[model samples]
Target chain A: MHKIALIFGHNDYTFEIEKNIKSHYKKIYIFNLDGQSVSKDSNGYEIEAFDLSEDWDELRDSVNIDECEAFCILEDMSKNIFLTLSLRETFKNLKIVALSQDKESTDKLILAGASKILPTTQTTANIIVEMLKKPMITEVLHNILYEKSNVKIAQIIVKNAQYFDGLFASDINWSKDYNITLLSVIDENGDTEFIYSAKAKHQQIKNGYQFVVVGFERDIIEFEKLIGGADE
Target chain B: MLKSLLLDAAYKINTSKNYTKTKHFFYNLLENSNYKYKKVFDFFMIALIFSSVFILIREVKSHVNDELLFYNNYVVSVIFLIEYLLRFWISGSITEVIIKQSEHDVMFGAEFNLSLALRDIFYQKIRYIISVKAIIDLLAILPFFHELRLLRLFILFRVFKLFRYAKSIQVFTSVVAAKKFEFLTLFIFASIVVFVSSVLIYVMEANNPASPINTLFEAVYWSVVTISTVGYGDITPITEAGRVVAIFVIIAGIAVFSFTTSLIVTAFTEKLDEIKDTKLIDDIAKKREFYLICGYENISKEVAKKLVQNSEVIILEEDEQKAIQAKKDGFFALHYDPGSIESYRKLRINIETQVKAILCLSHSDVENVYTALTVRSFNKDVFILSILKAKANRNKLLFAGVNELLYEKELVGMIAKEFVGKPVAFEAIHALRSNYNGIDMQEIIINERIIESFKAVADLECHKHRIILLGIYKKNKRNFYFNPTYDTSLEVGDYLLLIGNMQFIKEFTDNLHKGK
Candidate 1:
């Protein structure tokens, strides 16, 4: 898959997002709100100025719409929402990720058709800071976020409840036998809970239920194979 | 030897449980604003003072009813007498002074002179008795001594007792009292002007037959009336020389009066801001448990918004505008220097006991670090959470005693990278963390009752409640156990981390409380 990342706006957040996801994309184009008419090169990536008023015809001409994903991260919140709405309108199936300033803007960006809204708010920061107070959870989250560690978080859908042999979810020795930690379970109704939670403990493995697990990629793959393929 | 025995008996009585309890009860009723019944007592005393003074005022015009006069002259006087005696009693502990002096004499192996201790104690009592408040209290009870015609005049002092009940009047008096030097200068200047002008007027106008000012006393009164700008036409100067002296006196009067007015106005203006800040601090201190936010930045504002709905939150910002803005936004905020430790002390934040957490969320990394450090200095165990605005300042924040750090840029970048390809996972994580989709992550603790009701994690029935429990945090080990066996028994003091819709979480916790 030749993945292309179309990032809108240039600011502090734009740089970090581009830098981190640069390797995943075949080509990355940064649409600068203040860019000159001609395309400029910034750190080996192309930065082209584009007007929000334009119909985005130049964007479609420059990149393959099917293979590209849009990032709406304009510093101004209203502009970010406008860009998300424009991108969603032009490309019916484009995966648009938006950076929202707060809860109110998050709702606005969602209504503007952002596929995923990443809240950049002190409230979110406060929640994260609180979670990081736990030493083990902090290390686990840090590994998943910053480092290029082999540890990965993946979701597996249950295809056969018979695999558990009528035993409860807690009956399975996940980490001991499969070397994969069962983080949480999401039912067909989309209600998710930690596998170890009091409510999830005695639950029978039901078909179509998704299990979120964290482990090395090799272990996750092996565990998925043993449990049968996902719902798809 | 007899003196020591007598002193020992007096100390015993002073320290007796009954005596101390009676004294404490009266002290709280009369003086302690924090006492539950203090307001009631103040109201009763104020009403009594007003009625008594009203009776006295009415007595001058017409004869008051005999019954009303009897109550005011006898009952009101008795109450005032009791109040005065209580005030004098709680003013100072004489027995404490004598015992302390005796202890000192023993420590130094010196001769204990009973007379010296007595003299020192006498001065302490005399100081309290001669105080302005004490004098008013004494005069307020003089209606009982109406037999002495002169003492009957002191009944008007009952009105001054109103000053004790009204807090605003006391505050105004204190503010004015703080400008003692300025008031003293004005007094001296006015006295010199009055003397010089009165001497000149008496020498010039006392001989004028058409003038109202004949006696030296009348000339002195005329000069005072003119300098005060009252300008009573009855005391006009007839002589040309006398009129000139009056002109100079009038100009001096304006200067002196204006100076006095400005002095008081300046004092009030200077103290008003301080008074406001102190009041805010006092209001915050009343909260048994509150979150103390160090700054009113965007993040802290968000934090305060979420917490303020369910709990008390106080925002301390160094910038006056930001603090005022926070206040306008309907949060408890005070203009205080967050970076300075004095701000915490000024707020009287009992970090370990009262404050649930201290959040240092200033826009600047330096400010957050300094605030965290200041808070940490006051309490070693207070949970200090700070925002690391820049990546380079992580170590500095950690070293400055921030227990938890939220690096906004790093988290945003990482989340963006992680979810760009997987939309489902992105939505799930976002829902779990932020209010983007109304789902949130919360922690619930298991107590003895919860342990008793549900022996194992499976018994919680989180699935039925539609809430997800992620793991159990063991209290003793301070470690989280993820994906425990279904039969994993719960124990008291274990924290369960759950992720679900807030409504579902509420229902789940409510069910747990119901022990279902």
Candidate 2:
């Protein structure tokens, strides 16, 4: 049961960001700093409004900043940096994530002691939107966010393995034996080749190959032991 | 020892690299009609056939010089004989390459052994030699055998070879083949009408004293002439019953003629349209890479205009006027609803394997999202880039697996900010956005091969090439290094931002790939 604090200026993106992430948190405290005359409640969720230039100590006390996860989504880069610096000063381990309008501000946000920075670029948004469109991507995202599944991606290097030394990719029963999906292979030349590609199907597996596999953690461990190498 | 030495020499000739290269060249020229030199060969062959026909006709009509005609016939026959032999030699390799290069297993079925492969190649060669084209080629040289008077008739077969040069004739034949059932139905109906009319007239006129149709054959001939509206008048109906039957037959003849003509006309138009569509799809599919823009709005038009100079662009606009305008402006525009699967099917989206990206530039965010979803459903791996107007719709589009998203408001705000504070930087950005004197900025990924070939940044010689290396974005560190030092070495996944003239950039990229 994690409590979250969302700080936003009067921007259309804030509402969308808040709506998408609200379900993951137990309690959400939205602080609107634009001081616009708007509804205090959004679908039974309360929004607290404040002035642009405000006393940080008073706001921190009111929001119980130390006990909550904070999201800084200010529209202006400088303001977002200022808010992040202030939050970092107040609590060293607050786990503050800030939004940046561009690449240059992203560096500033990191320097301001934000635990994470999300660049509000259309490219980033599009990628996320695209992933949400696919059910498989949604399932993966849900699993990662909620810790609902043990499936993880692991890159394992191949050492001396007699069975796999000279066998084509199609000849190997990776999923049946190890419960792993062989996504790709990185050869000795550091070129990544998709396992299912026509060029890769005839490729003979050899030593010094790095395999990127997706499977349960225990199965990955078992596969690593069988291949005589640790996860990269 | 002499036999073994000769066998060794034969093996060397068979396995030599130059021999294989020559074989490949001849195979391409003879078998692959799409080959560049093959067109020239086809034109030459057509010219030769026409000249031979003219000479043959002249010999038949006028008192041409016997020696000149004989010499012309001999030279053309020899050329045809050589071409026939070359085609036969290359047919085996052509069959082998087709089997080896087909991407789908459905075409060739399971792989066969070496002996079976050889047998298949032999069968293919036999089939080719017995084909209509081969018969014509053989007939074109038959007149040279002057001793055989019967073979003189075979010389006319050169006219059949003209079908090879007429692509429309092949298309028309295929259309007729496909509509054979409809044609048979019309033929049966017309035959029934003629037979019934002939029988009725024969019955009515046989017993009439004043009837000219005394025999059934003469009555049938009269019906045939009247039904065709030719009215030969060699036979005529005399009685009232015969006259009434003739009137009905004439009316039926006109109706059936018009119906048959309209049917043929409609079928031809439909078949031609279908052929055009298939040819367009085939041409687009053959392209290795192209950009598919979903809308023909102002932004999309600008994007198409910019990309048209160096890259292939296809626009799918639902608005008929816009699509027509786009075509008028020299862009390939297809009027299709982007959201519908049927439209995608018509476009043969699934078969277009080399589509580099689909850009959804619709004004509505929802429409863009729908287009992205539809395209992704058809092809899971194609990169989808969409322009989003509203921030609220970002999550939906991101979930749809759009690889690139351009926010209109964000871009506008950034440009505005730059314009107010840094005018020079703004101008530079503006210049890069639109082509300024053929100069523009392009971002290229540094792949593993590039990293290995060029160990240091200085080796690229951007200065000598008149190109500027703006910055390098290191993927691993997620850091942008502006104006990297000459000693700095690039890594795999680094993006090199370069500014140069289009031609120079193309050459530089080519040279980089060539490891020059």
Candidate 3:
């Protein structure tokens, strides 16, 4: 099981991230770079004060380093860059998700050895605003992203291709038969494309190709069984 | 009967298509800086001014051929004359003034006063004639009369016409003109000092034959030279009284010069922001369609960057620091209060027509609402989108003329709520929403062509295209049918929400366009 660590510095998003992912992780640690001393937040998560200059030995002692993912999201972009650099220097292979303010900083964080960079400026709010223009699309995205509805997005690796043999990837009416939207396909070579993309449409369905589908939990489960595969 | 017939004929001519088109053509050529063709005409005028001035300068040193002189004397002058007339014609509409006056008279049951109407038209033309630009334009044509020496000297005024073509020069002159009151006071003071000093110096040194200052004219010259600190030793004061007067004059000269310098400096400094704002507006107006974003906070900064790829995005920021930051970030930003009507009015943006949309993205809901109302009052039909910070103020923003709003906190919270035990799903959804890996949700509107091309949902063959048909947003019902059935017949005005790679969607749309 993967553990989660949130290192925050005067940012508002850390609490929201922690609140949403709390139940998923067996052990979750909250570290505050801005404050001195330790205290429990309103959510009862203990906040441990941290310094960028440190080697992060205390963090390693509490959580299994190999099974942990860290999020670096400081509102001050310069400080966030420094923290990411420090964390990368301490843990060479750790998965670090860093929040970037803009394009320049996104490149900087990537260079700083962040495993993943979540750009705050370019992606979220702006895309949300664009989606809001179409109220129906916004509702669909809202449900798929946040709401606890039965609808979900899953990636299934096909272990058996008997049902899809001798058929092009687009030949199956997955939505009509299985009540699931087959979004994309990842071949054994790890090439991914939209299922209806010209290149994907011409390719024949084969075993070991991963399919990304979106639908209700029941429909996804039934489709997974029919495809002789499980979630990847 | 003749009077009514003449009035009807005049009104018909005033509203005629050809007549208005001609007026609009000239108006764009002479007045509308935003008009695309205006630049070409301005360049032509500038080239003419340069060539005419060059010929006049050339003639001063050496003899020119009659052919060259003829073109300079007649061709350039004729063009200038035509331009002057066009400018005067467009300066104010005489027909509008007459129509408004007649309408007022009719409403009040007053007798139509032909004399009063003529007087109004006379004053209107006279106002345009007396303007500094008009005077310069009128004088620029005088050079055509090469036979008259006095008129030839007026050709130098043609160089001043450059101000009419170059906007920066106009801005500089307007900045100086803003301090007209201060300069007027200084001018009166300096004149009085010169009058007194010239008289005093003349009375003190004229009787001394040894002194060079003899006549009042010479005394006036001496006073001007001394007060201006030119200090030519030839106009020296031999008597002690004259020396003392000279000393006082020099000191007063320093005071006057310093005051004038400080006044001009202050005026430029005060008008600096206004000049920049005007330039920004002109730049955006040149583009013709732009998103006017209010506030320069993080949300606005991000939105502006994204929107700039597709259209021009201008940010109106009230805070000086934020405005500067926005400019540094490569955005066109005006350091003007977004909540004030004066800011929009001064910008002269035709919100009803040119602005694509207005986005109020300030952190404070109150500020956003105020900005929305200010923009809405300017044009009731402008699409205003605001970011609502507080959920409680949603109705407040809606009431203030926000056509649509994005509640960033609520949206973020929703996304955050889904991170538990569904990390992959959350990631997949976020990735798709952000168009990561080229997957996105696109809305296609069913119009007449689309309806005819695709008779039913089955005809789209969305599965064959590999795009996910999320649902149809029925236009008539204003309702969404999730996972619509294949047999659902297509209808005009409905929106189909599909999720797929942008390339695939483009292919789908292209095929639909081709009626394949």
Compared with the true structure, all predictions reach lDDT values of: 0.78, 0.68, 0.79
Which is the leading candidate under DockQ? 3
TM-score for each predicted model, relative to the true structure: 0.69, 0.48, 0.71
The best candidate in terms of lDDT: 3
Clashing pairs for predicted structure model 3, backbone only: A196-B465, A196-B466
Which residue runs of candidate 2 sit more than 4 Å off their true CA positions?
A1-232, B1-33, B81-147, B188-256, B278-299, B309-312, B316-330, B335-516
Ranking by DockQ: 3, 1, 2
Q: lDDT by residue for model 1 over B1-516, one digit each (tens)?
A: 877796797689777999899989989898866566888999999999889888888988898999998899899999899889888888878777778778889899987668888898899899999999899988888779765768778887988988899888987998888898889889999999999998999999888788888888897899889888888878889999999998899999999879988998999998898767667765765688887888887777777877786788888889989998999999988888978877777777778878888888888999998888877776789888887878889999999998888777667787787775443444445445544445656777888777778889779876566555556778688666664566899988888877666777888888787885
Q: What is the interface RMSD of each candidate, in Å?
A: 5.0, 17.3, 3.4
> Could you give candidate 2's per-residue lDDT for residues B319-372 as a string of tens digits?
889988999989988888887788877766652566767888888888888988
TM-score of chain B of 3: 0.81
Give the clashing pairs for model 1.
Answer: A170-B486, A193-B468, A194-B469, A198-B457, A199-B462
What 10-residue stretch in candidate 3 chain A is worst by lDDT? A3-12
- The interface RMSD value for candidate 2 stands at 17.3
Residue A196 CA error for candidate 1 (Å)? 19
TM-score of 1: 0.69
Q: Which 10 consecutive positions of candidate 1 chain B have the poorest summed lDDT?
A: B421-430
Q: Give the local distance difference test score of model 2.
A: 0.68
